[model samples]
Target: MELDHLLRDAVRRLADAGIPSPRADAELLASWVLGLSRGELALKALTGLEVSGADAERISDLVAERCRRVPLQHLTGSAPFRSLELRVGPGVFIPRPETESVVEAVLGQLRRLGEEGIRRPRIVDLGTGSGAIAAAVAAEFPAAEVHAVELSAEAVAWARMNFEVLPDHAAQVTLHHGDLRRSPELLGELSGTFDVVVSNPPYIPADMVPTEVEVREHDPQMALYGGGEGGLELPFAVVAAAEELLRPGGWFIMEHAELQAGPIAEHCAAQPLLESVHTHRDLTGRDRATSAVLARAQRGDVAKWRA
Candidate 1:
């Protein structure tokens, strides 16, 4: 019943259950239970300390949930995004490391604009699942006005929880509940107002969703399956919305399925209001994010014609 033995057993069980990074996950759980850092856990492991009965029970329950395909982030109620640890749960999408590049791309674009004497840019995160992108943008650019939109009521609640726990800068983030493609009132509020628009929308083809155990079993389906053909409807909607939401010379960036980069670029090209459509690869060298500048004067032209 020693801590090291318990951790070893937990790791073995997780591995047997087909969980990736079993040892690392076990270590993280152990550290959380013991209220120690991972390095501290290593040192304490050598001492052969016994876990309290209550702590052992808690870890056992967590392990059982993991075996049931529940995400560790959900079990722990938190996920790390950029430098922030945001609360997560059943209704929210767990933030992934790959999406960090999306945040970086937004920040880089902001920095470039800053060099041109633009500061305190207004930014929006469409379909902001866990509010990861919005929160990160607020933290990185304290002066910016950040807003996030989510269609799911549960997701909006989870995002609001994350927003509450953030630092003072998080106060800058405004959360709206409604679909970007359909909510006219919500759309009107942001019409021609943002300097940057970013999103990590659901892009997995509807049929392909069932094949990924981690996604199908643990993540919310509404946050994953785009539609049939997976041709970038969500990202396209964000692009079209951005045409109305972003100021001329503003930028829109989106994280998408790596294989859909060409189609995403093509979609942006068709927008006519978006120029310089470009794809950015993730750390693993997969095309993961795309960005384009809004044609400034044309936004008004497009909006007026649509009106």
Candidate 2:
């Protein structure tokens, strides 16, 4: 079989299986089998390269697995986040493109603070699944000190693997294996020290099931849902944690479900430590992230907020 022809057939199969972005998925799977990047696969396919029988069979098997809704990132063993490729599999929640905006908001705030001569900012990523955000922050800001907290041992293994692969980036990031809701002893009385506290925590309501089989079946349950109604419990916890962890005038960036945007923003606004609640839209124009700034010296501790 010819490469482009095989790719077209794979796209048809994936599309028929109801996968979104079938062509992109097909190309990516083929690229993996061909030992090429997706761009390289596209170019090589146009050359009408002959597909070897072994490679063709491997592609067919991969496509079939994808048709079953196993995550493409799981099959490829990595997912792209910003410039880095994070290792992902059964335990970790693959970092979605939407969460990149959450990271960007933090990076943007860092740049603005740079103008004010606040270089080498301190950052902490709560629920740092696969260490995606932590690694990205460390890579982008070499001077920044980053700490990441995760609860799942399985997920932590994947994060550790990625950190090992990207030692230069992970060198600046400290990984902690503990629940985000409970501050680990590892943090060592570090409250009110971070310049930025960010997370893409599990914000899906516990009762709700994801439409995709990959997410519903493959993604870890603990990484998918927040406790209580409307998936706001964990997000609320995240806000409170950020308020505690961030220094005065620090920033908090987090991703949440689109529908929960208003409530999440309101929760942040209610935090005395956090002021200026700002919603940020994803590429699809959905409200995907929220950022709030901590109040400077004049404001008293707002930890006892009622609303």
Candidate 3:
């Protein structure tokens, strides 16, 4: 089938399956199959570009799997995030576009710090699944030293692959295979050293099932559910870890569910070491991330590492 006809049928199939952005996803898959940019694919589609039979068969299987609510990134074996295409598959949480704005938030803060004569800032990403945020920081902020922590071997493997593709400053970044809950133990050597501490940790509660099949089924549970109480437990620990890691007057930014704005802002603001808590909204206007400044060095919650 020709590219236009193939994408049209795939769009219909995906839409019928209730997939959002069917045309975009379909076009993206076509681009992946041909290794052409979406814009390039569109230009070729205007000329009725013919797809080879072998490639057509592969595209069909991918489209079929997408219709079943499989993640497009999973099918393409990569996810685009902040100018980088990250390798992704089972056992790793796929990077979402919303988190890109969180990276922007950090970059904005980095600029603010730059004005204050802070160069080559130290940064750490807790629970760095697929190392998306960590790698992005390393690539975008050339001088920042980045450290990433993850617990799952499978996810860490994918993160390592993603880190390998980072164009610059990746060697300045460290990937630690350890649990965030044990930040006190695992990250003790670097305690109170980082200028920026960030995370997009699992914040979904155990009882709250995700509506998307891609997330609920394909994504690893360890990368989804926050432990206990509305999945706030893990986020709370992230805050504590950030508190310990951030130097006085350092920054902490974390992505969480929209509804988590209130809880996160309130809890982090109350911490003696963290202040100026503010929630940030994504492009869709949902409260997607919150930022705070660590005001001082202080001991806080300690927990066993289950991850």
Top candidate when judged by TM-score against the true structure: 1
* Model 1 misplaced regions, further than 4 Å: 169-171, 187-189, 298-300, 303-307
Clashes of each: 1, 0, 0
Give one digit per residue, the lDDT tens place, for model 1 in 152-245.
9999998988888767744588888999885336957766778898989888876564664656777888898776567466777777877777
Identify the leading candidate in terms of lDDT: 3
Residue 79 lDDT in candidate 2: 93
TM-scores for all candidates? 0.94, 0.91, 0.91
lDDT of 2: 0.86
Query: What tens-digit string does per-residue lDDT give for candidate 2 at 157-271?
Result: 9888877766575458788899787753457678777888999999998778898888899989989998778988898988878777877888888899899999988877776
lDDT per residue (tens digit) for residues 102-203 in model 3? 999988988888999988888889999999999998888878888999999999999999888766644677888999978757877788778899999999
Candidate 2 residue runs with Cα over 4 Å from true position? 167-170, 184-186, 298-307
List ranges where model 3 is wrong by over 4 Å. 296-307
How high is the CA lDDT of each candidate model? 0.84, 0.86, 0.87
Q: What is the C-alpha RMSD of each candidate to the true structure, in Å?
A: 1.8, 2.5, 3.7
